[model samples]
Target chain A: MKRFTAICLFLLSVVALATPAFALRISIVPDHGNPASPQMGDRLRFHTAIQNDGNAAQEGVLAWISLVETDSGKEQPVDLEDWSAHKAVVSAALLPGQTVESIWPMRLIKAGSYRVVVSAMSRSGETLTASPFVDFTVRQKPVVESSRIVPVALSAPLLIAGLLIWRLRENRARA
Target chain B: MNAVAVIARKEAGDLLRSPRGLSWLLAMAAALSAFSLLLISDAELSLLDNAEAVYGMCAVIMGLGALLAIVMGVDTVAGEKERGSLVPLLIAPVARDRILFGKLAGIAMVWAAMYLLALPYLWAAGGAGQNLAEGLVSLALLGTPVVLGFGFLAMGMGARLGSTRSALMVCLVILLLAASPVILGPSLRQTAVGRIFDWINPLSVALNALDAVIIDSQAVVSQWLHWNLTLLFSGITLWFARDGFYRTAL
Candidate 1:
C-alpha cells in the first residue's frame, strides 16, 4: 500500500505538469486617418498585432475588435462579416514569435469619447488572452452650411405666396 | 406480446400525431441545415488549411445532435403524464419496468431517425473529400448516453411531480450541467478550481472524443469513458424513476 501511494503521488504530479502554460502579447497602433475628429459614417482604421511569446505554438486563435463608449459603457464590434465594407481586417492564427496584423474600421455614429478593445483566445484547452484598449475622440461637425441655407430657402416660398395674395387683393379693390 | 415493440409502436404513433413533436423535428432540421451550410461555406474557402477546421465543423453537427436529444428526452415522460393517459397505462397488464424501457426505446428510436436524416446533409456540407466515418461513429457513441441521461431525468421528474413544466425545468438544469464544461473549460484551465470542473464535465469528454475522431483519427476510449459515466448516471436515475412511479398515488 505504501508503494502504491508513492506511485500515485508521482503519477498525479506528472499529470499536473503535462498541461502547458501560454503567454501572449497584444498591442494596437492607430493607422489610416487621424484618431482625433472621427466623424459619423467615416472609416476609422487601426492596426493590431498579436504574438505568441511562449515557447510553444498555440492553435485555434480567435480574435475580434470592439469599440467601447467611455461615458455610457456601450460597446460596438467592428463588423468582420463585412470586413472590407467596414475596412476591418483579421488573421485567425499567429505563430510563436510571429506577429499578424489586424485592421479595424469603425463608424462613429454618436459623438462621444470612445476606446477600442482587441481580444484574442486559444480554444478551451488553454487560457491566453490579450485585451488592449485604445482611446480616441469624435468631434461634432459644424452645422454652418445647413444653418445658412435654411432661412433663405424657408423665406423664398413665403415671399412668393405673399406677393401673389397682395396682387389679388389690389386687383379686387380696383374692381 | 413483445413488450418493447408494442410500446415503441404506440409511442411512436403518438409522437407522429402530436403537433409539438413534428414542430420539434422541423425546428431541429432547419437549425442543423443552416449551421451545416455555414460550415460548408467555410470549408470551401480553405480546403487544405488545417485538420482542426474540419473537426470544428463536425463538432457543430454533434452539438446540434446533443441539443435535439435533450429536447426529446425532456418531453418523453412528463408530457405523457400531463396528458392524463399515464395512470391508465401504469394500471395495464404490462410490467412497469417494460413500460419504462419501452418509453426510453421509443424516444431513442426517434432520436436515431433524426440523426440518420441529418447525417447525409452533414456529409454533403463537410465536402466530398473529408473522412467523416470516424466522426459519425464517435457522435453515435457520445449521443447515446446524452439521450438516455436526459430521458431518465425527465421520466424521474414525471413520475414524481407529474408535471411537464417541472420536468422541462429539471431537464434544462441537466442540459446546463452537461454543457457547462465546454463553455467554462478555457477560464478553468488556469486555476485549480477550473481544473476540477473540467475533469468532471462530460461535455469535455464528448468533445475530446470528437477531437480524436475528426482531428486525430484516434480510438474512442476517452469518449467511451464519458458515455459510460452518462450510462451510470442514467441507471441511477432510472432506478429513482422506477421507485417513484411504483410509490406514486396513481
Candidate 2:
C-alpha cells in the first residue's frame, strides 16, 4: 500500500507539470514593426507577429489592423469621408510554440498624425488574444508644402515694390 | 496716343484719391503680410521645392485678382453715372473708344500694382532663380487676361445698366456663377455639369491653367483655347460698352 501511494503521488505530480505545457496560449510579440514616420503618398506597411506560446496549436487565427486619424481642433474622429483601407488577415494554423508574421499595406493619401491598432484574434468568434497601439506620422506632400510657403515669399517684396511704384507714379502725376 | 494716355493718366491720378482703391491696396497688403509672417515662422516651408510653393501661391492671389476685378470695374462707368460724374468724363473732347481704353489703362495700373505687390511674396515663397521667375511670369501673364475679361465685363454691364446698384447685383450674380467650381468639392466638381461649367468659367480656366503649368508642369500652349474664349469675351464686352454708353441717357 505504501509503495502504491508513493507511485500515485508521483503520477499526479507528473501530470500537473505536463498539463500546463500542453495548454493553449496565444500572444502578440512586439519584435519588428513599422517605421516611425512615413512620407506622403507612400504605401505604408505595418508588420505584426502572432506567437503561440503554449504547447498546443491554434488553427484559423485572425489579425485586424486599423488607422485612426486625429486632426487639429477636433475631439471626435473625422469622418473617413474617403479613406477605406482597413482590413483583416486570417491564418490557416498556428502550430505549438510558433509565430506567424504579416505585412499590412496601406496607401497614405492625406497627411496627418495617426494611430495604428493591431489586434490578434481567433477566427471562430472574433475573440481577441492581444491588442497593441502604434503611433504614426505622415509628412505633408511636396505640392502641399510648396503651396503654403511660395506665395508669401513672392508676395512680400511685391507688396513693397507696388507701394514704391504707386508713390513714384503719383509723384510724376504731381510734377 | 495722346488722348488715351492723357485720359488714362487722369484716371490713374483720380484713383490715387479714391478711397476704394486705397482701401483695396491696404487689404491686399495686409493679407500678403499675414501670409509672409506665417511662412517666416515655420521651418517646414524651407523644406519644400520652389516650384511647388509658387504654384500654390499663384492660385490664391489669382482668386483675389478676380475679386479685385469685380470691385474695381463694377464702378468704372455705372457707379460714376449713378453718382452723377460721367458727364464730365464723357463731355471731354476725346473719342468714346479712346475714353474707354483710357479707363481700361487706369484699371491696368491697379492690376500692375496688385501684381507688383505679389512679386515680393512670390520671391519669398519660391526662393531665388528660374523657379521664382517661372511662377512670376506665369502669374503676371495670366493676370492680364483675368483683369481684361472681368474688367471689360463689369464696365460693359455697368454702362448698359447705367446704375451702380443694378450693375453690382448683376456682376455679383455672374461672379458667383463663375466661382461655382471652386466653391464645390472635387468629387462634385468632377460631375458632367460641373465639368461643363468649369470649362466655361474664365476664372476657372485660368486657375486650371495655372495649376497645370505651375503644379503639373504642363505646356502653356495647351491653355490657348481658354485664352481664346477669354479674349473673345473681352472684345465682345468692349463693343457692348461703346454701343451701350452712347445709347444710355447720360
Candidate 3:
C-alpha cells in the first residue's frame, strides 16, 4: 500500500510539470508611447508578442486583435475592417522559448472609449490565451468639416449653369 | 482625317448648343455637388474612410457619364433620321463608319469635360488622402473604356433598329443587368454565377480596379488584366457600332 501511494504521488507530480510545456502565451504593447487619449482620425499601432511557453514546438498558431467600444451605453465589439485591414497573423511553427512579434496598424475612425486585446490559439491545442485589454479614449475634433466643402459643392453647378446659359444665348444670336 | 475632324467638330457644337444636352451637363454638375455635400455633411457618411468617399464619387461619375453616353448614342442615328438630316449627312464625303467615329469622338469630348468638372468634387471628398491621385488615374484608365463602350453599344443598337425608343430600352436593360451584381448581397456575389459574371463584366472590372488601386493601394501594373478586358470590351462594341452603321440602308 505504501509503495502504491508513492508511485501515485510521483505520477501526479510528473503530469503537473508537463502541462505548461505545451502552452503558448501572448502579450500586447502600444507601438508608440501609449496615447491614453488619441484624436479621431489618428493612426494607432500596436505590437503583439507571441511566445511559445511550451517545451515542444508549437505549430499553426494564429493571433488576432479585437477592439471593443467600452464607453457607449452598450458595450459592443467594433468592426476592424476599416480600422485595420490586416488584423490577423499566422505562425506556421514556433519552437520552445521562441517569440514572434507582429505590428498591427489601425486608423481611428470613431470617437469613443475603447479597449484593444490580442488573442492567440494553437490549432493543435484546446487552450486559448489573450492579453489584457489596453484602454484608450478617442477625442472628436470640434472643427466643422462641412464649411469647407459647401462652397465648392454649391458653386461648381452654378458656374456650369452660367456657361450653359451663355452658350444658349450665343446659339440664338447665330440663328 | 479632315472629314472626321470636321464632322466631329460639328457634332460637338450641335450638342453644346442644344438645350437638352446642356441641361444634362448642368444636371451632372448639380448631382455631383449634392452627392459631395451629402457625403461630407451626413453624420454617418462623414465618418467613412476617405477612400470609400472617393470610390462613391468614381461610381457616380461613371454612372453619370454612361447615362449621358447612352442618351447621345441612341440619338446619334435615330435623331438624325427623325429630323430628315440623315440623308444629307450620309451623302457627305465621309463613310458611315467614319461618321460613327466622329460622333463617338464628339461624345468623348463631353465626357472629358464632365471628368474635368468632377475633379474639385473628387478632391473635396478625398481630402488630402493619398488615394486621390490613384483614384483619379484609375477613373481615367478604366472609366473611359467602360463609359464609351456603353455609348458604342447603344449606337450600334440605334443603327440596327433605327428607333431611338427601342435602342434606349435595350441599353437600359443591359445597364440594369450589368449593374445588378453590384447591388446583390455579399453571399450572392460569392455564388459561382456571380463570380463568373463579375470577372467578365466591364463595370465590375473597373470598380474592382478602383477598389484595388485606392483601397488596397495596389500597383496599377497589377490591374493590367482588368485594363485589357475593358479595352477589349470597348474594341468589340466599337466594331459592332461600325459594322451596324456601315451595313445600314440609306
Number of the top DockQ candidate: 3
The DockQ figures for the candidates are 0.01, 0.14, 0.20
Native contacts recovered by candidate 3, as a share? 0.42
How is the predicted docking of candidate 2 categorized under the CAPRI scheme?
incorrect
Supply the global lDDT for candidate 1.
0.60
**What are the lDDT scores of the predictions, listed in order?**
0.60, 0.66, 0.82
Which runs in model 3 stand beyond 4 Å of their true positions?
Answer: A1-135, A139-148, A170-175
lDDT of candidate 3 over B147-220, digit per residue (tens): 99999898889889889999999998888777776666446568898888888888888888988998789987
Candidate 3 TM-score restricted to chain A: 0.76
Best model number under TM-score = 3
Q: List the residue pairs that clash in candidate 3.
A: A21-A54
User: What are the runs in model 1 whose C-alpha is more than 4 Å off?
Assistant: A1-175, B16-18, B40-67, B127-130, B183-185, B221-223
Q: Give a tens-digit lDDT track for model 1, residues B1-250.
A: 6897789767665544444455555555556555444433442222322244445545554555556555555555666666777778878889877887787777677767666755655454433434467667777777566555556666677667767777677767866776666555557557896666555655566676677766676766645666776567667766776676666534
Per-residue error at A61 for model 2, in Å? 17
Q: Model 2, B1-108: lDDT tens per residue?
A: 588898677766655545445656667777766655554454444334456567656766776666676666767788778788788878877787787788788777
Which scores better on lDDT, 1 or 2?
2
Query: Which of candidates 1 and 3 is the stronger one according to DockQ?
Result: 3
Of candidate 3 chain B, the 10-residue stretch with the lowest lDDT total is: B180-189
